[model samples]
Target chain A: MTQESAARRFVVAAIALAAAAAALVGLTLLAGASPIDALHALAEGSVGSRAALGETLARATALVLTAIAASLAFRAGVLNIGLEGQFLAGAVAAAAVGPLLSGAPFVARAGLLVASALAGALWVLPAAYLEARRGVPEVLSTILLNLIAAAAVSGLVRGALQDPRGDYPQSRALPDAVRLAPLVSGSRATAAIVAAIALALLVTLVVEATPLGLKLRATGLAPAAARAIGLPGARLRLLAFSASGALAGLAGGLEVLAVTGRLYDPFSAGAGYTGIAAALLGGSHPLAAAASAMLFAALGAGSSAMQRDTGVPGALATIVPGVLVLTVLAARARLTQKRA
Target chain B: MSGFFAIALLLAAPLLLAATGELLLERAGSIQIGLEGTMLIGAFTAFAAARSGAGPHAALLAAACAGLLAGAAFAAFAVAGRADPILVGTAWNLVAAGGTAFSYRLLAGATGSVLEVKALPPFAFGLPAAALAAFFVPAVLEVFLTRTRPGLALVAAGDNPLALEATGGSVVAVRTAASVAAGALGALGGALLVLTVSPTFVEGVTAGRGFLALALVVFARWKPLRLVPGALLVGGATALQYRLQAGGGTGIPYAVFLALPGLLALFALAAARGRGGAPKALGTPAP
Candidate 1:
């Protein structure tokens, strides 16, 4: 728990991560791939050019929001893993609202944002209630809610929000006015990236610099202490869940409004899971979470290149963050054990 | 109706297999949330092994071994270092997915042939081997838990680790062993899926059945006898989707069929948690 031990733990985690990557490359070689080609493809895909950078940033935009959302609740000692469900709730809401709004772009965007956040909070309400009153572990209820939300959204898209073309199990496209304008000329990156950055800053400010933030952290660290000091434990926990849900929903809404332009049933695509790693990697610090989200986003971008050039499945890239998270958790545990 | 019953049994086989091991592991106080990943790794390993000309029996063995290894690896983080089970479990899933997809592409590159492996030949009257296991594994587990000392030790690991340790039991050993066995069973479920049903490996093929089994554990309240009803209910709901598709039923969306079990499980959670029953020391690593 000392600074020296923390540093040592960080070094060990970094080493473990490097070893996992090395093992992955070795596995790729066993699969008949050239190590150089795989590495090159990864590099080229993530930061090789302006377009690739744009794509990576766009993906990171969503990841940043979700990771911060995760960090917020986790810092409050709540493992709110229902970000995936909450993400879907937001996306579906945005997709639905996009079609409802008429001429004014500002009104449409504002309405879509509120709708997404409201829907996200609504999605986590049941789990929050259960955890608060029934003593249900948030991990269990949220995961169950994730499956249900996925199925519900899939059903909604297929039945009511089906595109007129009817070729895919997806929602109708948003109008041009409702879409976030591209920040870069040739890439998918949009103004949402700026939104993500602003939100990250705001989150850091709220979580680190505010009295409420102190209360939330105290609630997580010592609920009894917080309660003795007149803080309402259940209410604070519920607020954290609701706020996290809103942020997760905003991430989903941003993806629909900026990147996909339509609601894809599987659009969340494990972002919720990925965001957890990102948050943990950042030590649950908002800015750090955003940075790690970008790191994961690059990994995701590089993976597509790996898939295209090496014929390796893009999912291979997802393994790196997973490995990082596992190593980090293990290293932290070792440190804590040793300290105790 | 008999055909429907038969199909539902087939549907329930993998879930039945996977949940039994998870039940054992949980009984021993470690919640291996990575069962889905374990199954995926099993399915892929079995498929790869079978494609290389291993017999179905050999394939199943390979799958179980893979599952055990995967489970042990997960436990190394979950039980060894006292990490969060959800975090460790999620990592295991990613590793399994990436490893399977990476290997599959390498082996089955461009112009890959549709390699078929031998399916497990059914026993009496086309009842697959898995169907037999599905029918009886619960009973075996039930008897094992109630009639054996080791089983009692496992239960003690879950509810009273300190007491068990005070009486000369090693909580870590019990949990580690239970976790590995659980992984092996989940892998067996994966093997059962490819060998008896699909007879092929697909990326992400377990399709949340492993996750569904987690709910089954909760729904059954950790009782082996109750698991049958829990697994079958989900299977029956899934089977309904197939029946609706085959019947050309109008106005019924497949999504409803898919979400049916999920909704049912959610309600079950609500009902079951009226008392908040689970092993007391579950997920808490022993010193």
Candidate 2:
């Protein structure tokens, strides 16, 4: 990249950080807390200790997975709003299968997790096929599918999948064999962080080294031109979308077998939406998206610390991402104008 | 019997208003997915104003103003800056969601399940208890969209921006205005929900109705004239769900019922087979 483009990227990042800080301050004032104290608390909570850092990394791992999923679809010109649905579906599937194979070996359980995520991708195939064949906008279809998935999951959890011992809408906990081993003994952080990093590396290698990635990027930039060059545009888009869904599903599966240990209502908690912002901020680069996801994970993990230390409400965390997105969007607009 | 219709009509009012407004915007070639957030802001603003002793009219005006401001802000991104419309719109929704929740906690001290506010009183016409306001509001919007020169210009801008530009009209200005109008109508929809429903503010009060409105725009094929029945269909579906759930039909999942309208809309669109008549440049940014 040129120095000017690099500087512009920095400017955009700075603006996003500034906007997030302002939003935190606004939220603090709204909640009758001192913004300075909240900032300090947030800093101390996220990175002050090794344990806090581990927790942040753990959350970032799942977020990075979702972000990668979003980046893939975005790079193929498909807007997969159904990531949220796919994520939930994958989580539920993993949660369902994890306990069933309590006697299975570790390798088998791992395979089951991957298989469950693939099933989640299958859940979105109908919608993707509809969009590819009928020209139904994926945006609308995916969103509607998300609602259906949410409702479906909610029903299953409330009814048949409900933990027999409890009345709450949650699934039975998975067996120890199915759970992802923790990376650090003292923290909730798991092997998923390492897995995510490896996946990010794999993504970078594929995007930079492979011909398929080239085709995908070409189609994203200009579908008409790509089609003119004899590329299978529709099939490529469908593959990208399915792969995106599978990645999102994998994130969900990891959360189930690694973090949460069971399925529950509001299982993903808008992780899919946050993933979109992460992908945008990352500019669809795997490593950058991973870093952005880590930033968001830090913000989310630190919000609780801010609340406890400075009496700021947790809502500030939610506001920060939105503020970041708007600032990034504005800066991107300015950068594009300069380029033009 | 009329009471059932009244309740259904009351429930349908916000959807009708918002969908009509969105219909106009889509007709002008700007698709706004931020209606949920815009409506939320409007609801909160209307609630705040009413709680602070503003009359119903003042609260409604405040809601419109809030919607206009939010819409204009979005326009600044999508129109002036030429940012991706979907990204900007989603950001607006997130902003509205987080901002409103934070404000709610601050203003209400975070205690109550529902934040109570004064609701707008229904204006009854002299015709045996059919409220005139419902019919009057839609009629007025229809006239504004079809009869006015600027309204026709807005549609033209969406339909053929280059042609409109050749005739000395600015596409951006028309789109921005349409967006603002859509926002106002979306906010009015939220305000009506507060007025007619429970006279209280609740989280997710709009509850994806704004999305349903967008679907209505597609189903109506971007015509104000067609949006009337489109709103009814959606509202009827929603009303049917509530009615079914209330009647204790627990065998079939309520979520399945909830999915019916959207699935049905998708089917209808598919059946139409590109004949549903979308704007020529519905998703593209204008030059």
Candidate 3:
């Protein structure tokens, strides 16, 4: 927390940014495009116009929520890597329930969102039980759960949750009456982003200012010491894990109501994993993680535009965050070694 | 029944190869959860090699080389650099996935046509030579881990690094070497897939097989030879799923078939109980 340390951290961030930028430039050149043009395209696509900004904000909604979810679990000493699966579970819940409700738009929307959150929480039960009872690492179990969820989604779209009126392998679409409306004319931005931001702030307040937050951090920081002091580490972990899942689930539900409108195979574009990367980049601080998520959303939005404008591939959006994270990790390790 | 067994063995070959390599790496005390990325790198390398006029065997060699570099790069960051392996791996997957997709676009252009590559020729029992050799990997690993001096040294590095250090060993060196070898094997597993069953490359051609291989290692309780049965079980399930799908209809939900392998792995994890014979120094940085 000292000024010197803060300055050192700034230097590390600068180096990492530089490294990522260098990688971006190299990739752009490899794609036979000028780096300047790519950069220009990226900027214009992400924030140059109202539509681009709207796209960025819309994407940020889910990323922000999932980042908070990842931060919550990580800070509570739980490695809940099933956010991807949990997200899918939430989306499925929304799709399954959204079509069944009628008459009142508000009630139907609320019902769908609640169902999604519950589904997300329920999805993690098996991993939690296996870890608590059988001493299986939640890491492996949660990853396996992700695979299962994906497989289930692929199946549901074709079989159980398929749209009866359509020939495609996808669930019934949510009626427009119940879906989220754009916040402004001619842009895709919706209330989902506002809700995501509010939730991020709330999580920050709970984790930083509350007694529960202190206990969660204490357990994560030192499980043995916390246990010796009767801190109920297991209960805290379970609470954190479930709450995290709920947040991710809510994100998924919002995505259905705000953007996609229906569930299908490959519903997520790795939103959960990218969210985890954002949390890591932010050092697991809820607000910082939200900011990182927004940045990633912008990168994703702009990369597609860049691809359209230039010949460069939009996969750069995925690669850049990874490069940044790896650089940060290596820098942190080097700093720790130096201090040692 | 014989046809089913043959298909199951064919499907098991890639999983067995990847799992064997992973077992060796974990035994040497470092874990690369990014084996999925390594496999992708290998798969892409083979695809590119084949597209650029290399023979199937040469493409395999190229992929193995790419795997070596991927392994070394991972070790540089996670091992020698002393970074958190898990975080490194999480990011590694993104980079590999994105990098391969980016490169594939460059190679294939904006064309939406399917690009096919030459498959490895079948040897015995309608299996490619590489696929047949995959079955022998676990046995070789079993002997290497139990009967050899270096193998014992690797175990020492995993279980008791300080003791190994006292006896003039370097944990970093052993882990790095194991990582490189593991990378080559994992890549070969991926290349074998493209060269045998799926003779064309696509985005994510391995389709979570890398992760399934990781589960297989856990199912095997970190024992090399035990990986065979675990891989076979998952492979058999996949074979069945394919057969069921080909038949056009089934009494059971097809989703159940898709999820069968993961479901089985979860049961295996829960049933096995407690750390399940994981290496003592697993996931720990070299002292």
Candidate 4:
């Protein structure tokens, strides 16, 4: 996509979002709530306080990582739909490995990150193999795998990994050493936000400056041509898939270290899926993905407040982001046609 | 033996229904990955309608209509509006899930107490209408597709829409109609899910059956006849595990049992190589 078209899409998205917001206000009225109050509550919950701001940043940090992973795979001509499964598996793997590492502090943290990344990559293996060997659609396989992971996560947390002392289906708490220290006291925010931003910068540089990035983009843009010219398209795809998995896994790792202190059922609040939305919203560009992730995170962080202040229910909370994405898609429909 | 067959058919009912419609949609060169979302809508509407005094027959119709509407909304963006099908489908999934859950909250309260209703009883020979429909629909469709002119036209549209357009067929019309019909089938699956196995509706009760149906289509090589065994295979995995869990708490984790069908589908897809039956222009929207 050219810069002009990208900007056009953004403009369309902005208009669509404003329309959606108006519709939401109308919805709040139908539900017998004060729309102005609801908006105020949403604003307050997202960034009104230091703690609220910190939480939003923390959520944004994980979203940015996952979105970057998604955009990377998409740029390489592979739709890595297995990120949900990868994220879940990565979270579980981090929890499993964290307690096992009793060595040096830095080594333990790095070990957690690496183990999560590997677990995520392995989780994506079956989908990758099916596409590579059997021409099976990766989209279907990955989606199925995500369903399996959903069922499996609750089972693992409740059965094998459950803390014996607790009645709930949650893992044992992470030791103090395994947890990432918070950047802001009295809030969930941690230095992972910095890491996420840094990673986005690094990804931007890699995609724009590196030969490897060029090859991946080339493969995505024209797989047939790349193969005709002997670009080892297959290997590049596999590499892209693995890298996507690793990044998704890293998001899960940060979630465990910086947000959740241990493995648990419902490990993520659809963070993996939202990553896809973030990538699309950002035009699949790394830095833009980070920005969009923050936007989504704010929406997410404020949803609860929208419910609490207006009696709107959690459904309205979920509907807003979905409507936003749908509107964006609607707005860009014309631009894509023009490009075609 | 009869009981086992009944259980298999019961589990396969939803998958079979959705796969049938999906075959037609695929034949018309459109893939609606939003079937899961559409199913969720159907499941909720059917349950709500039933709870609000609709008869079982009416409930099923309501579900199917809801599915059709949901599917149409999806196609408006996916087919007409020129959005990427995958993304549109994913967004639809989230919207349906959230919308249904939200609706339940508004109607049932924030507590989300399980809404109970009597299970729709089996008909002749102790089998659900869904199960019977599964058996007969494919047979009827197989004949209709093979013998009918419209079926051939649908196939032509899928293989090469541009050519079909040249031949005076409206590609958009065929795809949009197929998408709507497919949504109805997806809703039927969801309605069957709540009406048969469970006496109450729960969030995400369809689980991943919609996607499993998609996988079945792939495994069947887009052939409706082949989908029977494919549906039965997955349905059996799901049905048998529930029975196993009910019979006794085996030492195995329940999650492993739940995930069995997914693994089964993955391997089945891998083993289904060289079938080569996909419509050539399936995912590519018109320029």
Candidate 5:
């Protein structure tokens, strides 16, 4: 982190941003629309009005939490790619419990979110066990878990968690009495976004200022050296892994409480994966990753509007994040190589 | 029973092809965790080509070409550029998924309609020629790895890249070449899916087949010929699930069948005993 390297990093970020912007414009042109119209629509849709800003914040709630989840694990040297599975597990938990609870709204909400977080942590146990005991790569096992989770969701919607009152393959909806209310009238933004921001700040403080954070970073940065010093590498990894799962699970629970009232098959639009992209773009810093997630949320909100207004295709939301990450990865690698 | 076996083999075709390609790439010491993305790229290329009036075989060819390019691009980042393969692959999935979806909407014009392309002509037992040919790929790979000089060089590169370098060979070159070939095979695997049984393109049409193929390689313990039984097992399980779904009133839950392949793959990894036969230099940066 010398000044020169920091300057280089800034340059890399600038170039990557420029490239992403150019790609967006190119894609808009390819769709036979004027780039100016697409940009106008994108800005207007993401931040132009109250409703649009609300949409962006609502989307940011999940992305911010998941981004923090990814950053936490990555910072600890554990590649917990099963965030997607854990997220679904949490959503399923919320969907299952939200319908059955009867109590004060605050108590019910707390109970449901806790259950969802525990479910998400539980979902990752198999991957963790396989990796530690059988030497199986968590990468493969977690991905397999994702597939299993997706299958389970598809089945539960039809059988176990099915909304018996309706023919659709979806779980029973959460009662509005138990769900979070909008922060503003005519907008989707909720208290969940505020909670997400608070958590991000807390995690940043812990990682950047605490002794426990040093131990985790030490384990991640140098396993052998940490082992020589008698640090509990495995325990730290497990802690990070579980905590990461809990964060993602919380995201899923909030999605249900704040946005979608019910869990359906394929409920997520790859929120976990997009969150990982945000973390990568932010270089895995908690606060930076949260900012990146918010940026992505804006992109998603704006792109859908662009698609509606200028026929630019909403998939740009997915593509632009990917391109930025790829550019960042290549640039970082090249710079490191030159320094070495 | 015979009908079940026929359908099972047909279903196993794509997995077998993709797994074989993965085995080759891994054997060369570079793993593309983004094989799913590669397959999606292939599926879309075939669909787009066929929709644009190419015949089935020509579409397959187009898909293979796209895969070759995809493989080379991946090598540019993960091999030549020495970036983390796993991270590169994770991003690759996003790019491929979003790229195909964007292109599909552009091509289909937001109609959200079902546009079917012509399927390949059946070869035997109601299987396409490509599907039947997919079963023999493992044996071919086995022979290639054991008997061919280039294949041995590929293996050498994977097992001991420094030694290969001492002997005046470029690990990057061998890996890049292997990646290109693997890319073709993986794409063909995807094309066979659309041109044989499915005959249509959807977002994520390959589903988790790419992942299943990755599992198959690990289950096979990096052995070329061992992939057949594993692929057939998954295929049979899937076929049985379909049969059970069609014949309602079975007491077994439908989710179990849907999860059978992934569950089986997970079990295989757990049972495989600590990367016993994995390539020594698998996922290592090319020298």
Candidate 6:
């Protein structure tokens, strides 16, 4: 990238940060809280103490995994809006399978989690096939699929997977052995963050070093040229789609086993959309995507703290991300226009 | 019976109005994904206006203006600035959803219950009135699209902007106008929802109907003429699902029924085998 482009990106990032801060202020006022106090509480909640830092890291882990998933597909020119659905599918699948293997050892339980990831990847194959073979637009198809997935999962939880002890529509918690181990003592922050970071590095290496990665990026830049060079564009897209789904699935599985400890209706909480913003803000680079995810994670975790401490409604966090995405998209448009 | 037809007419009115506007916008080579947001803004504005002592017509007009401004602002970003229209539309939705809720809390003071607003009194021309409006509205829109001079220019802009530009028509102006009109019509749909269906404003009240209208436009292949049947088919399907749910039929999940329209569109396109040709320059910007 040229210095001009780098400078432009920095400007865009700065604008997004400023918009988020403004939104926070607006929301604080709307919620009848002091914006200054809310900001202080947000800062103190996110990084002021060790426990807060751990919570931030734990949230970042899930956000980063989903962000990486979104980054991979977006870099390859596919807009997989169904990541949220795929993430839910992965969580539900893991929740279903993890308890069934309670008699198995820890390694076996971990293997089941990996299998859940693959299951999530497999779930996206239909949409991928439709896009690659049938020329159906993935955006619309995936969005429709998301609605279907929500209803289907909700029904399953209500009908069969309902916990016997409670009427709440959710699956039973996973076995203790299947749960992810925490990285630090006295914190819920798990080894999943470490795994996500390693995966981000692996993604950076694959996209930069591997032949498949080169083909993927080539297809993303110019599909016609990639086709001319005999690059099997459809196959590559399918792989990217599945890999993206798998990463999203991994995030879901981690959330279920590590954070929520069970699968339930509305499992997503808009993580999929947040991941899209993270990937876009990060310019689809894996490491940058991780960093953006951390930013979002901090906002989410701190927003709750702000609400608790300063009486700001927690909706500010939700509102800020959408505004940030809009600002980033507009900035990107400006950049594209400048380049043209 | 008149009752069945009346109910059908009421159901079809909003869809027809919204789809008519969408048809115009799509014909100008710009799809507004923020129809839902535009409608929400309209609904909220209309309700607020009505609550603040404005007459029904005045409230409706205010809604239209709000929709027009919202649409124009979105077009400024997506069309003039060349942002991705989809993302811009989604942003509008996010803003509409959160903004409306925030504003509602501010105005209504967080009662944590459904709030009611005065509904527009329907213009009752008696027995023949509903039928006449339903048929006449779409018929007039169709004629305006195909027979008007600016309509031809708008279609030209969407179909082949370079050719139209060669002929000395401004594609951007036509598209912007169509976008504004589309926003107004979408807002009208929202106002109609408040007036006819629920008689109040609620969050996410449009309930994906705007998107369904978008799908209908594509299903109609940008033909205002074909849209009548397309709208009826969609409306009929929606009515059927509601009827089934009302009758307490549980064999098929309601979600499956809800997804039927999108699934049907995909299948129809697949069955058509890529032959339902879109405008040549649709979704491409004109220089």
Model 6 per-residue lDDT tens digits across residues B1-287: 45445555666667777888887887888777767778887878887887788877788788889889877887787777667776677566666766775566566664667767666555563322322354465677777768898878888988889888899988778888888888888887787777666777776677667766766666666676676777677666666666765786577765566556555555544443332556676667666
Error of 6 at A109 (Å): 4.3
lDDT tens digits by residue: candidate 3, A202-306:
999998889999899888889999999999999999999999999999999999999999999889998988998898888788988899999999999999999
Local distance difference test values of all predictions, in order: 0.82, 0.76, 0.90, 0.81, 0.90, 0.74
Across the candidates, what are chain A's individual TM-scores? 0.95, 0.95, 0.97, 0.94, 0.98, 0.94
DockQ of each: 0.57, 0.51, 0.81, 0.63, 0.77, 0.36
Candidate 1 chain B least-lDDT 10 residues: B268-277
Q: Report the Cα lDDT for residue B203, model 6.
A: 65
Q: What is the DockQ of candidate 1?
A: 0.57
lDDT of 4 by residue, A1-340 (tens): 2234546866876786796688678667766778888878778888988878887888887799888988888888888877888888889888888877877767888999899899888888888888888888888888988888877887788788887886988888778976888886877788888988899899878876799988888898899998898899999999988988888888888788788878887777788878877877676777777787888888777767778777776566556666767777777876767766
Report how far residue B207 has shifted in candidate 4, in Å.
0.9
Each model's Cα RMSD: 2.3, 2.9, 1.6, 2.0, 1.5, 3.5
Among all windows of 10 consecutive residues in model 3 chain A, the one with the lowest summed lDDT is A1-10
Residue pairs whose backbone atoms clash in candidate 2:
none
Supply the DockQ value of model 4: 0.63
For each candidate in turn, the TM-score is 0.95, 0.93, 0.98, 0.95, 0.98, 0.88
Docking class of 2: medium
Alpha carbon lDDT of residue A216, candidate 6?
A: 82
DockQ winner between candidates 1 and 2: 1
lDDT of 1 by residue, A1-340 (tens): 1123457646865876686678668755775678789879888999999988888988898799999999899878788878988998899899888888887888888889889989988989988877766666787778778888788787778777888786798888989888888886878788898999999999999988899988888888788999999998888899989999999999888888888888876667788878877887777877878888998899899888877898666777677777877887788777778777
Off by over 4 Å in 2: A1-4, A105-108, B2-4, B55-57, B110-112, B122-142, B272-275
Which regions in candidate 6 have their CA more than 4 angstroms from the true location? A1-4, A30-32, A105-112, A181-186, B1-13, B46-59, B108-111, B119-138, B194-196, B199-203, B246-249, B253-275
lDDT of 3 by residue, B1-287 (tens): 38888889988998898889989999999888788888888899999999999999999999999999988999999999989888888888889989998999999998968999999897888888899899999999989989999999999988999999999999999999999999999998888888887898898888888888888888888999899989999999889888888896777887888888888888878877848699999998899
Summing lDDT over every window of 10 consecutive residues in candidate 4 chain A, give the lowest-scoring window.
A1-10
Off by over 4 Å in 1: A1-9, B110-116, B248-254
Candidate 3 Cα deviation (angstroms), residue A318: 0.9
Please state the interface RMSD for every predicted structure, separated by commas: 2.1, 2.2, 1.0, 1.9, 0.9, 3.0
